[model samples]
Target: MVNLDSSIAFLIYITAVSSAAAGVTEACKSVIPFLATDYEARNDCWEDHNHAARLNHYKRFFNLLISVVAAGVIFGVMGLDPALILTGAEKVYVEDSWEVGTWLWGIVAVFGSPFFASLLKIVEGFKQSVNNNLPPNRPRQKVTGPRE
Candidate 1:
């Protein structure tokens, strides 16, 4: 069975990492105008009759690249193995080793961040709806720990 506390902590950590990556990407774009892909830039591109399609393609690629690099750096500095974190596996090997999985985890974190945020919101809404719909006279159920 999944450990509820650890699972929750993991979710929060990943969400924070994703948010940090996004923040870094935005900061980079602000400092480096070449990375900016805002709506205004798109409109400007169209007005100037530039290759908007190529611009869009490069914009997406750079965004993904920046986020992945940010996430990878965060994970690397923390000395956390993305694969083990995702799988809940105990670390049994050398801690200092850097592998390809670390980079892959960066990709996963970038894409999964939004998904995880939406899931948390959905779960929260569901819980609120269930609580609101319960009979007033009925006592709310208290959750202590995971059930056997």
Candidate 2:
């Protein structure tokens, strides 16, 4: 089994869960007609600014709700323990009947999905930077004769 206590492993696990929640939100948008509407009105005709604004607000709320529900299902019903490590602190796992941390993490995961890619990019860049800054190893010299 994978060790969730490790930083890298936890990062991968959270990212996967967040991406899955995002996918679920997208799927919900496709299946729900109201959630899929892009125009100001359902008929795809231009409507009053206020009406369009209201629709947009409602759509955003529903999208967030769907994302949260998806995350909850992933973490709760799926029996996946929600865990995270803050800074250099010890690992934190949320395991309880109520699963408050699970829901909280679910919300964070759903909202943070968009930024996860960027975060991974940043991490990769940092690793590359560190690797580049390290001194290169000296090539071994050929010893044609006995060492001095």
Candidate 3:
């Protein structure tokens, strides 16, 4: 029996499922900064500190929104793209290499979210190094618990 439902699910899996996953991956890649900060940075939003933080927040949101939508559209319409055509004496198989690649990318991105978050710090460090600037000296605190 040809399972039409299974076939449909498979199509969806390789298409929308992976693509949506990629979107989530992109969001994680984009929004890591909000999570990477220490408590001070978290509180800074309420402190009304200055930076293009508001702009950055918007930028991240749009990037995530676009990436997800684009991935969904691309994968759904293409159904595994950049295919490789292989021909034998009596058979031919067109392989969906692009689909596989995107699938792998989505999976890797999900697993690498923490690494992505820390990457923002590394990038900031490099930027600071290039610009010859350092964060202000913070007070030395001997903290034993959350009260500190």
Candidate 4:
């Protein structure tokens, strides 16, 4: 059985880990789109106003890019199954000695809040863009004439 203090420490550790995970999630959400959009806008200016082409030209707009690159390292260092880590829903066959459930649960709480906040922001951004019919990070286009 783990000591009370140790259990508390472990819980804190898990919370910290989850916070780190959340940070990465937010960073990826923000960075990837910024990169892709910038790339797409530049492509749009260079080429004709081919919105179709710009839309079709997909880019790696997520942390999956980094995760894929570090697959080997992540598994090697953590001694975890790469497949499991990649999936994030992996269950290991380790025996549970102490009741450290609180830590894992706490991690979810600590991480989930910011994640949801960021997600809401992203959603709001999308909603605004769609509502106004304008590109993100740019002013909404003015209505020129009556809609058909």
The collision pairs in model 1 are none
**How do all the candidates rank in terms of TM-score, highest first?**
1, 2, 4, 3
Worst 10 residues of 2 by lDDT: 1-10
Which stretches of candidate 3 lie above 4 Å from their native place?
1-97, 133-148
Q: Pick the candidate with the highest lDDT.
A: 1
Model 2 TM-score (2 dp) = 0.66
Instruction: Decide which is better by TM-score, 2 or 4.
Output: 2
Candidate 4 colliding pairs = none
The TM-score of predicted model 4 comes to 0.28
Q: List model 4 lDDT by residue over 1-148, tens digit each.
A: 3333333333333334445554555566676564335333445464644653555453332443333323323223334331232234335222431224423343343435456456545655665677798855756777788889
What local distance difference test score does each model get?
Answer: 0.71, 0.69, 0.46, 0.42
Q: How well is each residue in 1-148 modelled by candidate 3, as lDDT tens digits?
A: 2233333333333344445656665666557665333222445474444344665666556555555445545543554431121111122122453445544434433444456446545555555665677665578978687674
Ranking by lDDT: 1, 2, 3, 4
Q: In model 3, which residue pairs have backbone atoms overlapping below 3 Å?
A: none
Model 1's lDDT to the true fold?
Answer: 0.71
Q: Once superposed on the true structure, which residue ranges of model 2 sit more than 4 Å away at CA?
A: 1-5, 41-47, 82-98, 125-148
lDDT of 2: 0.69
Candidate scoring better on TM-score of 1 and 4: 1
Number of the top candidate by TM-score?
1
Deviation of model 2 at 108, angstroms: 1.1
